[model samples]
Target: MVHAFDFTAPDSYILNCSTLLTELPVLERAQAAKDAGFDQVEFWWPFDGNPTPTSAEVDEFITSLENAGVELKGLNFWAGNMAGGDRGMVSVIGAEDDFAANVAIVVEIGRRTGCRAFNALYGLRTEGQDPSGQDSTAAANLDLAARAVAEIDGTVLVEPVSGAEGYPLKRYADAAEVVAKVRSEGPANIAVLADFFHMSVNGDDVAAVIEVEAANFGHIQIADAEGRGAPGTGSLPLRDWIDRAYALGYTGQVALEYKQDRATAFDWLSHVTQTA
Candidate 1:
């Protein structure tokens, strides 16, 4: 049960249930995380991409965390149809209402779970749509979400994603630019989500980003570069990158958002500690 990294506190790292432990039902992943020695967990839009889920569904989602004795540290606002290739609607032309409606739900979740970090993914570019208009829409939606989450003392996150074509925000600078635009309008608590796997895949210098952009990062997620698997599965120097970020003063939980079977997903932890 030894962890890969010697985190100073139980809450230092979060197991992203949305990606890990896929063999079990979504609700059961929390308990699995707890059993595997994680005190906190995070998720993508969990209700089948439904923005306005039923009251019972919300209750059940909350109950799962409570029963597992794990904190819901991070959550994603509804992005449209992830399986169908929709990254998010914050910037999409026709999905403004859906994005707006999801903001309230996200706030409620934050209020109830003390989850303070919310990631809002920017949607893909629509055919025949102006990029400028999409950027404006993204900024506005992010502002609204930032304001709503701020009521709960939460920060909204903009992440650069890879592997999805037409999706904007492919680099740390891209996301940071969007964050800067939103912040320019007014004071809203928003920051860039530094997912190392995505940034590296998109050809960003991960070490340089950690060195220069640490102050602008709200959260961090990690998976190896070539395959997006566990830390040691690919060529990424993930341990070094994480250490560098911490050395540069990043005070947030690092999320384990890699793809692997539950049985062997965490094997890298021991491998890392042994090598270190």
Candidate 2:
């Protein structure tokens, strides 16, 4: 089996500790990533309210990275809350002002950290406080998003969630359409972060999307259909994802993001194999 892309072991994977708020003291997590042979790592908006970490904190984090020999791929500020906002709080796309503020912060964080991308949310609406209006807001937000994407030294990706795990996330919205909008108005830096779990939830054929929407994919994160865990632990065919990624010309990081009691990248090793 000739693999499409060759990713590194101990290379960067998005370290999603957003759920584990108590554990987000970045130095400890980054050091763990370094020890696991990971070349790089990411935080989901490590700081709130602003994009760049304070000069002192950024310097300290960078020093930690240097000491650990860890590189940074990028960061994710999934809408306003960065990662998952506890107790059902999330960003509403129609709340245009808040949306802009959050993404701007995401951009700033990426710029200062030497990170590569920002991830924001178009959250879910259940009983209709204008779920349908999100795209419009997302579109309206794009002009500003364009400004951010164009000037942003890094890239920005629109991440729509599957409404699982108690998070208020938008479901089955047109990610392709939104991304196309981003690309048109601004720098090509804006793209999509394809989460395989969301694919499974929405019955999206991820491999097929990869074939056609390959160029749109800026990042790829994975877990199985049952309980977001390492690839191959559930229904997602790990081998197929690799094959399709290769077939589709995607040679980017396939970050492993799953929930386990302890923070450990090694847990994904047996469940995933990157064959050359």
Q: Give the TM-score of candidate 2.
A: 0.76
Clashing pairs in 1: 4-269
The CA lDDT at 14 in model 2 is 55
What is the per-residue lDDT of model 1 for residues 39-93, given as tens digits with 9 covering 90 to 100? 8999999999898998899989999999989999999999989989889889987
Please give each candidate's TM-score.
0.93, 0.76
Error of 2 at 160 (Å): 3.3
Model 2 alpha-carbon drift over 4 Å, by segment: 1-8, 12-24, 48-63, 81-104, 126-128, 164-173, 184-187, 263-265, 268-276
For model 2, the run of ten residues with the poorest summed lDDT: 82-91
lDDT of 2 at 276: 16
lDDT digits (tens) for residues 185-268 of candidate 2: 655666777877886677677777777776567788776778776555677786577567756677667666666554443555
Clashing pairs in 2: 4-246, 10-37, 10-38, 10-39, 51-109, 79-120, 79-121, 124-169, 124-170
Worst 10 residues of 1 by lDDT: 267-276
